[model samples]
Target: MNAPIIIGAGVAGLAAALAAAPRPVRLLTAGTLDAGAASLWAQGGIAAAIGADDSIDLHIADTLAAGDGLCDAAAVSRIITGGPLVIDSLRAHGVRFDAGLGLEAAHARRRISHVKDATGHAVTTALAAAVRAAPHVTIIEHARAVALDVAENRVRGLWAETAGGLVHLPAAAVLIATGGVGALWRHTSTPPGADGTGLALAARAGAVLRDLEFVQFHPTGLDSGATPMPLISEAVRGEGAILTDETGHRFTDELAPRDEVARAIVRHLAEGHRVRLDATHLGAGFAARFPTIDAACRAAGIDPARQPIPVRPVAHYHMGGIAVDARGRASVDGLYAAGEAACTGLHGANRLASNSLLEAFVTGTDAGTALAGEPDAAATTAPAAPPRRI
Candidate 1:
């Protein structure tokens, strides 16, 4: 019997593979395991209610507040409650986070667990290593899933375009972990291949997409003319950096919600003012705390420790996607999704900083565990009506 097919190699995909355990799994990626995955570029850490002053209720309330009243209450409760377990799972896999939690924007308490400033890179690297060593997981790099194979309202498998040629692979179930659609926009902080291919594939397979318009634009993307602009970590602002216009006058509050901050930056640019993130007040501690941002700024010929970094709003995340249940089951049978590719309604219209990683871990685990329990080649069944689009 064929193994379950999992597409994309981001944090969610790798987590799904590991969660499947003894069940054989085929992990597919458009590029090398870490190359095109946006999870590798995340500078902010994962949000978990692990602080002495933090509680699950506070985390859930913060998430719902950031989501702008469109979040799924039950879904928010589930993922936020599972956060500490996710952290422990990562640590058991050899991913080490900073000794204590750091705060990010919109959170009422300090609850972000990190690895310096490059938390995503550290987590993905460790998870990828575990996936590589798993006996039941087979990784297929440079394989882009072009379309799903659906028959009689059920997903049969998928066709992937590989370097060798196009190939059709069979599966008992298919899980889409393809990151997000940020790359579809002009200015973004995502990899080039994050063009909503997974959403398209799911839609083609009769999966319902929800909240397609709720794209989250990150404020303070470095305006260095890079294809996918480098992001200035929000943690920088949480640590006391301020936003100033070209005239050196402080404007919008740096710690506002992402959507508000992004729109304010856009407004500033419309008024012919160049918005800058002034982190010079952070002094030398800036480099020690945010080595990734420091290195990126230096690469763009700007020293963040000495000068303010020019910034702009850029597409960063999709708060909507292929609609799914808390267990990550899509509308179609034998089809599932997790991570940024799947809209479990945990994020709603806007995403809280660092919650993306949390959702990815929780939903990916649920999807993989559910698939592992299914029969290897069970007959497909028609799904009920798809979820309503917001």
Candidate 2:
């Protein structure tokens, strides 16, 4: 029998495959299951209102504020409440978080659950491992999806370019969890593969898309003459790190919403002011708290503990994608989008820091759960790209 197909084996795709459960699943990734995903580079933790002093309402308000009050209140409340449950589900899958929650900019409380500074690495790695061991799931690595085979306004399957050649894969449903469009920009902090491939597929298939105008720029990317700069996570700023100009004058609020900070840096740079992030106040303990970031800094020959790291604004995340409902279903039937590929409207104008991971897991689960109750996938003569014979 044809199985439901999930594209891009990032956190969202892994979670969807796991949640689809005893139902057989076919997971397709452009690279290996463990590589090329932008999710692996996530340094900050996932946001969830599980802190003792935190409440769902406060989390919702904080998210809205970070989003510049452009959020959908209903969707914001719904998705934020799924945080604790997402944590619980991940733990059930053998993923262990750090002892305490982390605090980031725009949060009223410390509600970001993490595993050190490598939260994305830790979380996505665990989920991918669990997916590997799942009995009913089939992982197809290095198979880049080229197009969706939509006929009569419904998705039949997709055409992907595999190692041998282009082939048509039939599925009951298609969930696009491919990451954001950050890499499309010249100075993105995202991996090279995160170039809006899935978003393009959705557009080609005529899926409803929104928030395409809301790309976010991170202010603290290490400007180390790198192609895709390494991110100096917001958690560093939350921990008393400050942004400075050439003469060591602080230019912007270290903990403001990302857009404000990114704009400040850009404007300052346009005025010929050099920017740097001084984490000297954090001292040597910075390495203990953020080993991954410390390593990245060291690789660039900068000791963040003692020196001010060169910084600039770079494309970070996209707040818009294929618009989806609460169930992560997109405009087309038998086609769903999750993670950074789907615009659930939880993120209105901008995404609150670290909320990306939570959205990935929650939306993936929702789409998979919704699919569990659906009928089996139907077989059809799907279309292939590059004039390949099917």
Candidate 3:
């Protein structure tokens, strides 16, 4: 039998491949091996429960609260407790983290881990490098899985449309880590490739899906006219930024849950009031801290230090996808999912800010480990391509 296939190359996909180590797997990527993933665009730091004043239970409580009681309690506890270990795993893969754990809105303590404003870039680049160096992984780029070939409800293989052409690869198991559906929206922070491919693939394979409508719009996406709006990470507000209107008067609580804050912005905008994020008080420290955001603002011809950055709501995260269990196993056998593509009942109705990266890491690692423990690929049928068209 051929190796199991892992689709997507974000942090979750990379983490899954690394955890499946010593057991080879085939990985498919839709773009550049290192940069094209939406993970590279994530601005906020990851959340972990390792801060001096924090505890796993507190983290769980905050996640549950943000999720608005829709989260699975056990899942919340399990994943949140594993965050520190995820941090350790990233470091083990040569992902260097910058100074300071951050505090995101809705969290009672400073439990977010970071490599400054570009956490995603640092973590993704490092993990991709580690995977490239690993002997157990084979990466095929610019390839998108179009369909899963399932027989009798078990996934036998998948057909992908690549730069070369259509090809099929048989495997004993397949894991979907294809990220989110944010790009499906008119204004979003997800890459164009994040058009719900994993959810589609999983659903096509007869995998159960849930909560397909729980999209969380971020409150402070830079109100630029870019196609996919540049995100103003929650960390900015968690630090000291404030939300103000045209009159420069504070309106809603800046650190409220993402949905609430976004709703406030949307309502304010609907009423014809312009909203802005006042990071001006942060001064030059803003540039040194959020270089990516600062640069984007500057490119928009506005200095964050001198102006209250123009802001609005933009779809940032999906709190739904293929339904899966604790080990990231989907309802179907021989199939698994992690990251934004899989709804493991953690995020619930609204995702706690910065919890996405943490979920991606924990679930990916869990899924990979489970895959490694499964029956060896050699015990399965050989690769079989779909029938050719006339």
Candidate 4:
């Protein structure tokens, strides 16, 4: 019998692969498992209700506020309640987060767990390592899914572009954790390969897509002329970095929700002002706290500790994609999605900072568990419909 096939090798896919353990999984990646995934580029860390003052209700409230009234209440409740479990699971897989939590923009409490601003790298590395060591998981690098093959309204297999040219991979189940579509925009903080391929494939397979218009433009993308712009994490602002216009005037609250901050930057730029993120006050601690941002700024001929870093709003996270249920099951049978590629309505119109990684971990694990049950289970035939948009 064919094993389950998972597309994309980011955190979501890796988590799914592990959770679907003992049920052989073929994990496909467009590049080396860890190299091109947006998860590796994430710097803000994962948000969880793990702090002493934090609670699942608080996390849910914050996420709903950041989502701008479009989040599904039940979905938000489910995911937020599962946040600590996700963090514990990651820790169990050898991912080390900081001993203490830190605050991010718009959060009422300090609840972000990180590894010196390289949280994504830490989590992805650990998950990938676990997946690689799993006897039932097969990592297929450089295999990009081009389309899904559906028969009788259910996915039967998929067509992929491999080194050996196009190949058909049949599967009893297919999971799409292909990340986001940030690459569609010229100015983006996503890797070049994040072109929403999974969304496209799922749509072609008759899966319902959701909230495609609600792209989340990050407020602190480094304007260094890189194709996929480098991100200056929101944690920098939480740690006292400030955004300024050409005249060094602070125009908006640096800790505002991303949509508000990004709009402020865009408005400034449109009014003939250059927006800059000034971390000069951070001094030497800047390098230690955010080595990634510091190195990126230095590479672009700027220094975060010495001067303000030029920044602009760039397409960062997609607040929408192939809509899925709490279990990451898409509307179509045999199709599941997680991560940025799947919209479970946890992030409605805007996403709260650092929640992306948490959602990926939770939904990925849930999807895997669901798929691991009953190989001959009957599939749902609901038409592609997301929860009612707010």
Candidate 5:
């Protein structure tokens, strides 16, 4: 059987490769690992239902409530119910989640998986390693997909530009695991290359894209001198950091939903106020617990241990993308999506804390099973490259 073609080697694509490996798969990525994808910069943990007090129903309800009015019930059910399985899968792949933090607020119990504060990095590292070990999986680094190769209302393959030359790779199936459109905004935590490529590709291929306007803005992005806002992981605040303004007056509560917190931070900025990350409350232990945030604060000339680190709201994740069903199948035949690129309605208008990685794991495996169930067929070659346009 011909290998399935996967685009964008971020968490979603890597997860898909690991699940479908040894079964014929070619993974294409635009840049070196950890440089362009938001997954690498993610510092929080993964949401799950493994906590003794938390129920799958509670997590689903939080996710649906946070998503606002656009969440899909069945999709929410699938992800919420699948959370424990996803965590187990990660552990099997060598991920070590934090212990003894029973379900956080908004949760009935503790169900988040973590490896210190670097859960996303650990999960991506493990998934990438697993894929690398799979001989059936082909890795094409520095290969940027220009567009989806579709013909007669069906997906055939993709057109990509590689370091060598323009190459047309055919495949029995295509998975668009490329991430969000965070680049559209001026200040974003998304990889610069993350500009709406996935959306453009899916839309060009005649797929239905939804909720493009539901972009999520994360509060507490370091306001120091980072060109693209560097995020101060929510887990820090969850661990008791405070949000304040320059005068040292508390502005927004740390526990507020992300959208509200982001909007509030933006409003403060427009009012000429400087937002601050009050890690003084967390003490020297702050740097010990969240090394990334500590390093970022120090690099920006702020000693978070002694004073507050300046912060602002920045575009983080997209709450919408190529619409898909419960099994991660796109509306188009022979095309599937997982992770950030595919919106299965688990994250409504806003995502609950640490749920992004969780959704990726659950849907990636589902997409793999669904893809493997397809009939064997010959792959169609990609067409000639077209002129690039924004």
Candidate 6:
């Protein structure tokens, strides 16, 4: 067997590479670190069972309920149980989660790991830096994987296009962590580059793509024409930010789960009523706590100190992808997936407030440990001939 090919250098891809440590692993990305990924843009933190009041069972239930009807109970249970361990591993890798705040968001207890509000950026950046330093890992940026090649019912390799031309790299195992399918929508908070490429590739290889219709719409994408629309953290509501219609009438409680809040905001828009994030209560202190939101509101010419930040739900995440077992292995042998691109039933219908990163950590290591038991091998060079363009 050759080194496993891990696609997408987002948090999940980085985790997969790290998990496949000591084994020659090639981690590939469609763009630069944090460039085409929603992982970096995540304003909230990772969900965990680190709090005394919050048990793993509770977190698992919330995830399944949010996942709507498509969640796998066993898979969700596995991720919740392993959540804290994954966070600890990332912390060991130098990812700084927000601490000493008592409690951050969503969790009934203080279980969230944050690095200020830019928690996703903190985690992804830390993982990418660590991956760069790992001698066993190889990162190939500016390479777009167009498809997965499967022969004998197993993933064989990937077809990628680079500045030089198309390159086909065969692997002993393939891990698809290419993030979500947010770009499929007309308006989205996702990076334009993460347009279901991994899902497409896996499906092309005869992998099952479930829950394609269940897209999670975030309640607060800054309603400006900013490239890669800025996300107003859900923590805002947890911190007393209220949602109101155009006439200053409160429509829905901000503390509700994301799906409810997003649906309410969408309803208001449909009824010709605009909604906004009211942060005036915090006064000047609000800007200091959520600098990212403050800056985004300021750039859009809205004053969080004085007025509400305009917002609308945009496709922010997908609760679906290449289906995987609790160990993050895909349907195909020697193939695994983690993070947003791999659906391990952690997110049944809708993802919990900050479980995406947690799942990446847990599943990433699970896939890694599973692969580590296998024998190592020489690096397999890509095929000399390229497939015809699509």
Candidate achieving the largest TM-score: 2
> For candidate 2, lDDT tens digit of each residue in 1-390?
578899988899998998899888899998988799988999999898888888988999999999887888888998899998988887887778889888888888988898889989888899999999999899999998988888766888888889898888877889999999998899989999888888888888879999899999988899998979989999988888989998999988888888988999999999999999999988899999989889989999999999999999999999999999989888888889999999998889988999999999988888888766667766776543533221
lDDT of 1 by residue, 146-215 (tens): 7777777777777777898876777889999999999989999999989999998898788899999999
The residue-by-residue lDDT of candidate 3 on 38-68, one tens digit each, is 8899888899989788899899999999999
Clashing residue pairs for model 3:
none
Q: Could you tell me the lDDT of residue 369 within candidate 3?
A: 87
The residue ranges of model 1 lying beyond 4 angstroms of the native Cα positions read 378-390
Please give the lDDT score for candidate 6.
0.78
TM-score of predicted structure 5: 0.94
Superior candidate under TM-score, 2 versus 3: 2
How accurate locally, in lDDT, is each candidate?
A: 0.89, 0.88, 0.87, 0.88, 0.78, 0.78
Q: Residue 294 lDDT in model 6?
A: 90
- Count of steric clashes across candidates, in order: 0, 1, 0, 0, 7, 7
Q: Cα lDDT for residue 378, model 5?
A: 67
Model 6: weakest 10-residue lDDT segment is 381-390
lDDT by residue (1-390, candidate 4, tens digit) is: 367788888889888989997788889999997698999888989899988888999999999999989999999999889889888888898888877888888999999999998999999999989988999988899987877777777877777778998777777789999899899899999999899888888888889999989899999899989988999999999998889977889999999899999988898899999899998998999999999889989999997899999999899999899989888989889999999999999999999999999989888899888778727423433223221110
- What would the TM-scores of all predictions be? 0.96, 0.97, 0.96, 0.95, 0.94, 0.93
TM-score, candidate number 3: 0.96
Mind giving the per-residue lDDT tens digits that candidate 5 earns over 275-363?
88787876888878778778878888888889888888888998799998877788788788888888888888888888888888788
Candidate 3 local Cα displacement, residue 350, angstroms: 0.5
1-390, model 6: which lDDT tens digit per residue? 366788887788888788777888888888887576668887778788877677887777677766666777888787788877877887898887666432433456666667778888888888889888999998889988887766667766778889988877777778888888888876688888668888877776777777776788889988887756788888777678888877899998776778888888898899999888898998897787788889888988988989988899888898888888877777776777788888777677777788888887777778766766654433545555534332
Q: Once model 1 is optimally superposed onto the true structure by TM-score, how far is the C-alpha of residue 122 displaced, in angstroms?
A: 0.4
Candidate 5 Cα errors over 4 Å, as ranges: 33-35, 102-109, 379-390
